[model samples]
Target: MSASPLKILLCALEPSADALGADLMAALRKRCPEAAFIGCGGALMAAQGLESLFPVDRFSVIGPVAALQALPAALKAADRLADLAEKEKPQTAILIDSWSFSKIAAMRLRKRAPEMRLIKYVAPQVWASRPRRAQKTAELFDGVLCLFGFETGYFEQAGANTRWVGHPGFQAILAHDSDKAAFRARHNIGAGPLLAVLPGSRAAELKRHAAPFRGAIEKLLTDFPDLRVVVSAAPGAENAVRALAAGWPGGAFVVEGEERFEACRAADAALAASGTATAELALLGTPMVVAYKVELLTELWARAVLTTPHVSLVNIAAGREVAPELLQRDCRPERLAAALAPLMRDGPARRSQIEAFPAIARLLAGERSPGDAAAAAVLDWLGTGKTP
Candidate 1:
């Protein structure tokens, strides 16, 4: 008789999480070819053989206030996930990113299916904000697969079994071997100055950042007329990205879908929305100015909880200002121009960012592959042999 397939209920609520889930699913499949997945995920995981119980788009909104606005929808998604977990009774449930939604669903799942081994992929930046979230995580998850090494110890201290799995975001950068010159040539971009503009992958993020990023570009255009612009359009954020990219004073080229990383590789510098792409920018050794804007109410409360001095993960890992982060009013066009101008050209700020990449890569890429490491951790938690 054939061995029973390991049943996993995996939930990923954003682009970054979806990609991680896809990678983990592949790694797990190699070990347990008959493993079946049931939960929510995007195209990548679906392609990796996850036929989700519901669409992934339902849980897309991010950030504090923005996430609050989507609470009703998010709650519905969370409830449905809990219901699925109760009915399916998967041996394990791996909640990837999306803390708010994951927390709600996890809590309910634990109550409904106490036997399910709950694992959380990508620990929250409790080191950055909401330190007590570690305690909350301990209460919610049986195990947490962390991307950073420090996170493993931090959460372990909080009474949860957490493992260091490096970071898939940085690994994506390390694995990608794109030729900048060829990429630039293909895009018909001259070497004088190429700017990569990333206004984030979510609708709320694009809505908040597109105008300021555009204004910054316009401001730079006055000083550098020959500057070439490439906007990194997030998958599923096409219309929003087009609306924003279309308005750039000096025409901007949009790179979406699979080509986004190529655009990152070709850019001289980037004005990016503070997220996973920052890791890619750092991996490509590109100088960057990270910008983020949140609703006033959210920013006000976030400041209180946020303990880290830097916002960009690259800088956070480096323990210094590798990439300058402009948040709230500091993310204004004039301030953004001031921060980005030096990066667009060769300067100390830009050089510092470049110097920081190797360490970031080293810190993120442990001895083993991040995706595989995360998968092994999950399998071990499931009492399944961790071998393909």
Candidate 2:
């Protein structure tokens, strides 16, 4: 390894992606400690000394309405990021998730500094929907790093240099993320059924999921009066969570910030909005019922192009319905309650999820740790590492 630092540009658009970026940065630093990280990300990556050109939240938004409103700012940030890359001329630029923002920056970087090794850190779900994006990604980046084993064929066939680096978060979760009893004791939660509610992290998610989610909790409370509810809100969505919880009756505890994980660990089962949270719950060995409700327009759009059998990562990874899914109109409060009731009491669905954990773990685990592989791949693409 060289004593001289390598200036590597990295961008992460959301908390999950920021986490992956942080782990990758740590690994890059271990092999090359003086490496300088620059570009956009959240607190986690900022702690790794990332010289962010803008706040990571500037790039976070979901749904057509929110995305439309945020477009101008998002474009300005992407152009600014590309300008930063052109000015600094980093050896490489690794764009993590947030396909919307990353692709724009990638195109801009290619326009100015065509020689920079532009790597797509996490491939988008093109195989599931909008398959044209595979060729689009191939046209933009020099290489692609995939998080799942099954994703390689899509990018490879599209003519992109791709590698399955596994997911660093999965390894981190399995290693240190579960502590059920401690969570219960800290929150004063009893052995009686504890249901976790994870609405979502983004503002749009809060707006869409909060009301219906509250209705579901209320429905459950009527039946299981002793049941304790812990609403685990995403980082930026705490105020929204509190606001929604205020209208609710007794027994629902709202946990946010770092203390939020306590909700996941403390829960008997979870009613979660479909996304990465479902996978996290599965990794925690907690059974969950996943649901999603987008605007009718988006739902229609999703139905038109969606190829995947299930939406939640746990079910997707299981290659079948490990956790029951209720989407669109089916995500009504009554339906949500119906689906979640069994899991709260260790029903068949819960047992099936528990039994499926080992397989999910094996499917996601990398031979080497995720960070080690991600760092090696990035460095190798940059023509630097002395091979581990």
Candidate 3:
């Protein structure tokens, strides 16, 4: 008789996580054709055959203030996930990013289904702040699949089984052939100095970044009248991004879905929010000025806890500021405009950043695709009851 189908649970609480989960699910399906997926994620994971337990948007928040605001709902959702786990009794539960929510859900899963293997897809930023989380994460999950090679040591030192699967975002960005002319033609953009503006993926991020980003763009338009702006809107933030861009001085064209990459490749410089988007821009060889802002209380807390000098992943990986980061109070219109001005022109500032990108790309590249590596790691654990 054939073996029963392997049932796995996956929880991805944000669009980025949803994409990661989707890639993982597809790769897992290739390896274990009979595998069944349950739990929660967004549309991407849903397309990959996951029957999500709840809408991921409810828990998609950033920083302490937003987290506190969403806590009650998040708690209920975590419990619901635990309840689902009890009923489904999947052999494995893979929790993607959104660290706090995953931690809560993992704890509940531990209580309800102690026998089931729990895995964390993305390790917390222990190297940057909250180093103690490595030990806590080690205690919670059976294994961790790290996105960066540097992440493995922390988790391994804390006594967790860890695999460095690299970052699939890099793989996707590297593989894509972005057509600059096509993107410009599609939007009727001319051969002027073009700028790609990526605020962020979340609604909260858009709300925080909109004014400053707009201010910067308006300031830039005065210096470069022919400056064409393209706003790359993330999955759930398209409407907000459009609304935000509409009020800009010279007007901005908003691109969603796959076209964002084209805009990234087409632009001379990018004014981007510091996150996964920065990494994507780096991989595309786009010189950029990275900026971010959060609640005042969160900023204060972050200032106290953050050990790293640079917040951009490209900067962190390079061990230097590959891209200029204007964060919190420094994320003002004039500063952002000044920082981007150098990048938009053909000068040493632009050349230096672009030159540094290949090395950063090499640092992130793995022997195989991240999806295949992650899927193999998960399957290896299931087969041997150990992390490979």
Candidate 4:
């Protein structure tokens, strides 16, 4: 008799995880054509044949206050995921990012189905804050697929099986054929110095970043009257981003979906939140000023725990601040504008930042695409109890 198809569960709570989950699914399909996927993810994952149990956006909360407000709903979602696991009985479950949600789900699944293997697609930044989480995560998940080489040691030290699967962001950004002229013509923007503003993808991030980003743009306009602005909005955050950009000094152009990459490539400089966008901008060779703000409580908590010298991945990888970072109190408009001024022109400051991009890119590169590497790791773990 023929064996049944492999059933795999995937859970991704945020936009970035959703993208990672989708890539993993596609790569898995290529290797194991008969694999079946279920559980929760966003649009991209849905395209890869995952019928998500619920809308992932409901759990995309950030900061302590937002997390507290969404706790009840999050608990309910965890239960629903557990119930789904009981019913479907997949052989393996891969929990992507959204550490809080993933932890809850993994614990619930462990209680309900001890035999099923649990894998974590992205390791928490335990090296940055909450070092104990490495051991906790080790106890919960059977294996961890790390996005960076540096992450593997933390997980391995905690006794978790690990594979350095690389980061999909690098491959995705490097693969894009960005057309500067096309993006400008589509938005009716002139050849003047263009600034790409990436506030963030989550609602809370948008809320925290919108005001200061707008203020910074206003200041930039004073220096370069012809400066054009383009705001790249993540899928669900498009409308919010558009409204926020509407009042910018020169009336910013808002691009969603794939056009965001084009905007990033076309811009002379960017004002971005200190997250994945900063890394993406770096990979695209866009000189930028990174800024971030959070709730007072969250900021205090983060300050108490964070061990990393820099928040931006580019800066972290470079071991120095390649792009200027204006954070917390310094995240004001004037500071942001000051940091971006030198970057907007073709000068030593801009060249210095751009010169570091190639090295950062090389640091992130892996033998294969992240999706394929992750899929191979999972499949190998299932087959021979080993991972690459």
Best by lDDT: 3
Native-vs-model 1 lDDT? Answer: 0.83
Global lDDT of each candidate? 0.83, 0.81, 0.88, 0.87
Cα-based RMSD of the predictions, in order?
Answer: 4.9, 4.6, 4.3, 4.4
lDDT of 4 by residue, 85-177 (tens): 889888889999888888988999999877788999989988677889899999999999888766788889989999988887677778889
Error of 4 at 261 (Å): 2.1
Q: Model 2 segments beyond 4 Å from truth?
A: 1-26, 32-93, 98-116, 168-172, 201-225, 247-250, 361-369, 381-388
What is residue 128's positional error in candidate 2, in angstroms?
3.7
Cα-based lDDT at residue 75, candidate 2: 81
Model 4 lowest lDDT segment of ten: 379-388
Models 1 onward score TM values of 0.75, 0.76, 0.77, 0.77
- The C-alpha stretches of model 4 lying farther than 4 A from their native spots are 1-26, 33-91, 104-116, 185-190, 201-225, 362-367, 385-388
What's the lDDT of the predicted structure labeled candidate 3? 0.88
Ranking by lDDT: 3, 4, 1, 2
Clashing pairs in 3: none
Overlapping backbone residue pairs in candidate 4 total: 0
Sliding window of 10 residues with minimal summed lDDT for model 1: 379-388
The CA lDDT at 52 in model 4 is 89
- lDDT tens readout by residue for model 2, 1-388: 3344688889898988998899899999999877888888899998988867887685577777888898888888878878888898787889998888777888888887776788888899875678899999998888898897767888899999887898776666667654778778877876788988888877677788776788888889877888888888776677878776775653787887656665676688898988878877877777888988888888888889988888787777777888889888788889998888888775677788889977786566545677778898887767653211
